[model samples]
Target: MLKRFPFFLMLLVGLAVASCKDDEDKPPVTPAPDTVSFVATISGSQQVPLNASTATGAFTGTYDRTSKTLTYNVTFSGLTPTSGHIHLGGPGRTGGFKVPFNSLTSPITGSQVLDQQTADSLLAGRTYVNLHTTAFSGGEIRGNIQQGTTAPVPPVEFAALLTGGQQVPANGSRAGGALVAAYYPATRLLTYNVTFSGLTPTSGHIHLGGPGRTGGFKVPFNSLTSPITGSQVLDQQTADSLLAGRTYVNLHTAAFPGGEIRGNIRERRLGITLGASINSAQQVQPNASAATGTFTGTYDRTTSLLTYSVTYTGLTPMAGHIHLGGPGRTGGFKVPFNSLTSPITGSQVLDQQTADSLLTDRTYVNLHTTTFPGGEIRGDIKVK
Candidate 1:
């Protein structure tokens, strides 16, 4: 019986070992998914006012429930989106859109830690993608949240000026031509207007070459014998090449089959205009009115320069200046106004820092007075 007992004990031990070995040889057990991904097709069905039905789009994204993070990517055709958001709603149902996308670039690939409300909505599948544009303030395209996957989009935005002088190394092309091309980052749409003189080219093309080096053609056009104007939807690689500043417009002439007038492509002349109306409501003392003014400004992004066209009246202006401030709040001095007195009307050049501050659209124009040393009337500069 003792020997039998010993054999029984050994048998039990062997069984236990065999069980553990079986577990080791088995495939790994996968943990439950901690992230959710989805894709949405955008079309007129989700559009507001029944318009912009022509617009089509796609949105793909992933939300990590554990980390409370949301990453998204979007692509759209038929319209440009000025603002985008993930709104709280349901399929076939519409709701308020408040969750904003900040620092947005092309393809809408940005990350935002989901707030409690947004996270809840996402889990419940009550969140959707919304895009707003100039024509459609409500929404141009939208899609309900679903489960899927989407890769991120490459960021590319470009503009280029066509000129004989901007040619590679030296623009020896006595044949003159000018072209302005603007490429939409998200959709890869290329729209251009070209006019040329001094040479009749059989064709024109945007070649894969830079300031000093010349390479093969990337996009070709019909004979530019006449003024060339139209649009072209580019592929991904071609768009990337254009945005890298490795592209140029070279007119093909019978005289020079290789190329004739060539101008390097780059971001075209860029500028922004800002202005705001003055009212007592915008002042520290809302009642201190009758002292109104207007702030007009234009900024050249390339030069980092600003030109101000300011005019004010209805106050004994002690001084006029551009102050860095927000809505209903005041900030420190940014740039001094030329004329310290009232009826200040003139143009002033803003330094780089001052120009940058205005670009934020947060600054205001302050007119000081002896009676009201703080400020008489203020107008917040609004980019136009």
Candidate 2:
């Protein structure tokens, strides 16, 4: 029995050795690539930190090569950040930009793609991230972005600017004071800059009405005077009226209870002659190719209709639509392409908010092709 046991043990050992030899002869198992993570901490001392204040902040980034998307998860303390960026450079080093933020409002998160050069710089541990605010146009808080493991923070892009102006009193008080208004489409915050030389206005309100017409007040100001600035968070209804071109700012005084000065609100326009440079660099999906296009558009706020004519070169058109986004950020679909002929003519019945986006340069026109599964040529539809 002992002799038999020894023989069995030796047989088992031989079998194990044969199995190991087979494994060596066969191809080795390959591991899948991991999702790369990066982090940054910004302070006044960091080279190239905007240093808007003695403030500080942090950033987290993840890169997914399958989708070729880079997403940022960010947080900041002791600072108010309006925008952010991923710039190329080593610690205490100054370099160019790699990726720009899609949005930087509170609860900051943004996603974007980078060109090959920028992507290489980032993966090689040669980049930094930063946050920007009104006070700090360059940047506020910044941190060196390095590859390391940290808890995951998911992010998406915030981003818009809409502007219009009203001259006091279409027919009433020729009183001085012009109201320049800017609407942030992303936050729905409306700001007004008022300047006047003559007139003692008791109060002022943005009312819903037309030139020579009167309606209920929509947004009321805290006070009125020369070189005054105020901001209001807009409601849906008020935004609706404003986009319809039926709203105006009126300065009310004891001298003119109805309104001393009034000016109508209107939308701006960007001519169709927009020469758009189309290339893979601008595509949501990264590639390397070039295309050309143009966008001509006219919008009427009262009717809420946007008419457009688009032209393209270097590809056959498969499909097209209007997208709500800017240069570096990809946004949701808003409208579709209609005209099939040269100088394709299409019209969109937009909502008040959509109208505001068109006027504020928040909307874009895009054309897709079979060759290029993604967009071939796109132009930001702006009010120039």
Candidate 3:
């Protein structure tokens, strides 16, 4: 009996050891990471029916890998949102689009295909969010998504100049063969217009793919027409994707269908403009180059315009201009200025077409006068 009891105890011990070993060999079961969320606020000026007004809205979205769904909830306080959607593509990268939500009042959400291709592209930073409006008819606001973070704020808007020069003139507008680009801070909207000094563009349009890709690639947001002052807007999804530094703006013409002007858009930290006026007291002092006196303002959601007052130290404020390119300090050829006159002050209509340019930070503001031949004073339009 004692021997039998010992055998039984040994058998039980061996069974327990085997069970522990089996548990150790089993695969680990880890809980998925918690979902991340963010809120994107869009505040900018837009062209309305009778007059141009400002629009202010916010969007909340979440990306869940466990569910493979991207959900959005947008709200507008100042103006009404006509429509909006989530698009696919990087800043300049071109690709097909899938519409998730069509209206702004309701929650916009959807899931992506859980595949190796989609996952790889996402990791490579090739996705974004976009919202549209009636005034823009295109996309009024845009934002991109990245791993580890949710609802990152976009920096100040800027423009990309086609002119080789890096500085803007204080007097006459740089109306040479240039394309005007604009950016919106909150929505990251980028808008662009290609002007040929009265001569229409034969086959000019904005390229969505990177600079390495072909110039005559597919239309960015839609078919961009030339010979007209009219502009086109890029999708928010596309614009957001651009924030990852994979997108670029490439202008094409019959002479250079592949591309004429090309530059990567980024956030603006400074503004350079030439301001001069041959007036009574300041005839000789037509050039402005003072650091203390600069044009600064706040965006009025009521009007969708940036209200600002210019304080001159060396020169007088005569004509104001805006460009879409890079920081110009010396002498650069930028596009026409989007005037923010009366009803709105220092406000550029951030429509669909111009929104695309603004996202790339390819826009600038300048004060021009007759005194400064090229440009007396230059300051970059930076965002706080």
Candidate 4:
């Protein structure tokens, strides 16, 4: 009886121990729903034609994973937001998805309820928050709610311009040297000067244009102006266009109207043209050995004008004009003289001032032939 009693007690103890171990191995039930908090920067090229500081704000929003609900509190610093919404969809898709917040005013704040799937999508980076304004009815500020990562700061490329060099002779000067154009790509600010042969000068201006095309007014050249010097104070939009190969430079004179000496300026590269050498304005010469090309469209910046006339001719054009350059040799970007789209013929009216920087000598318009895919005939513009 005593042995049996001891065995029974030991069995009970072992069973109790085994039961507790089993319970410990099992996972606990899902925890009650809790709110997830996150802060994100919301910015976008909200306006169709985006500009600096267009999209603004740090938007704060919260998601209740348990209730599948979300709320957003947003405010802008510079511009007041006229409209706001919580946009759904990833990178490329239609804007319509969900709207939780509506009628967002300054110090924009709002809330919305989301379903389980939508909440999951938002966490997965399939959705985003966006705000709208009068300037950007589409959307100005946007942020993708997801696992955040830090971004590395970009390095700045800066340089200084040197002044005072040996003077060059009249009617003749040395060539082949580095010309520095200090440009801030983000702002479109430019400081440039050319250094070459010794020569004397009265004053100068930087022409914006290319073959047979002269750009708008001059960006005054100052002391820092090198061999040939000038400053083309430009806005961010204008500067972006200029960097897009739409502007150039030419030190002007009463003698050289179109541009005395011209060089097409683009990002990092410059094409120089002597004022005396080139064909007549508006004359397009085609090459025999090359595939045909033509002047198709014309656009003016200062005036905001645009004209499209499809004209095509075999060979390529030698000379053309959107004249904006003065005299001397400095050209920057170029406008589209001939393109795959509309070609040009006789006379064509142009836009008032649409992307006018493109019309400046800063761009390129060369005759392309089968033999010369690069270019066959070329000419820079001078104001006649």
lDDT of each: 0.68, 0.63, 0.45, 0.46
Q: Return the TM-score for each candidate structure.
A: 0.32, 0.32, 0.39, 0.34
> In lDDT terms, which candidate is top?
1
Give the poorly placed runs of model 2, Cα more than 4 Å off. Answer: 1-280
Ranking 3 against 4 by lDDT, winner: 4
lDDT of 2 by residue, 1-384 (tens): 887998999999999999999989999888746578887766543434222144656777788766767888877777777777788875545677767776666557878877787777878877888676787666655676777765322111111121222233323344555455545354455655556645787887888885447788978877665655566778988876776667877777787776766656654322222234344556666555566767776765446677777776676777878877655556777887766445677787887656655654557777777877567666766454
- Could you tell which candidate, 3 or 4, scores higher by TM-score? 3
Instruction: Kindly provide the TM-score of model 3 when superposed on the true structure, using C-alpha atoms.
Output: 0.39
- Over 1-384, each residue of candidate 4 has an lDDT whose tens digit, in order, gives 887998999999999999999999999989744876655566542221222233456666677776677777666665666666666664333356586455566566766778776777778766766666687676655655553333211111111111121111123323222344545344344544465333343444554553346567446556524454343447765565465555554444345333334445544311212122332232233343423333334443223444444333554444333343223332432344544432543333444221322333322234434555435544443211
Candidate closer to the true structure by lDDT (higher is better), 2 or 3: 2
What is candidate 3's CA lDDT for residue 313?
Answer: 52
The root-mean-square deviation over C-alpha atoms between each candidate and the true structure, in angstroms, is 17.6, 21.5, 12.0, 22.6
Among these predicted structures, which one has the highest TM-score? 3
Whole-model lDDT, model 4 = 0.46
Better of 2 and 3 by TM-score: 3
| Model 1: how far residue 226 lies from native, Å | 46
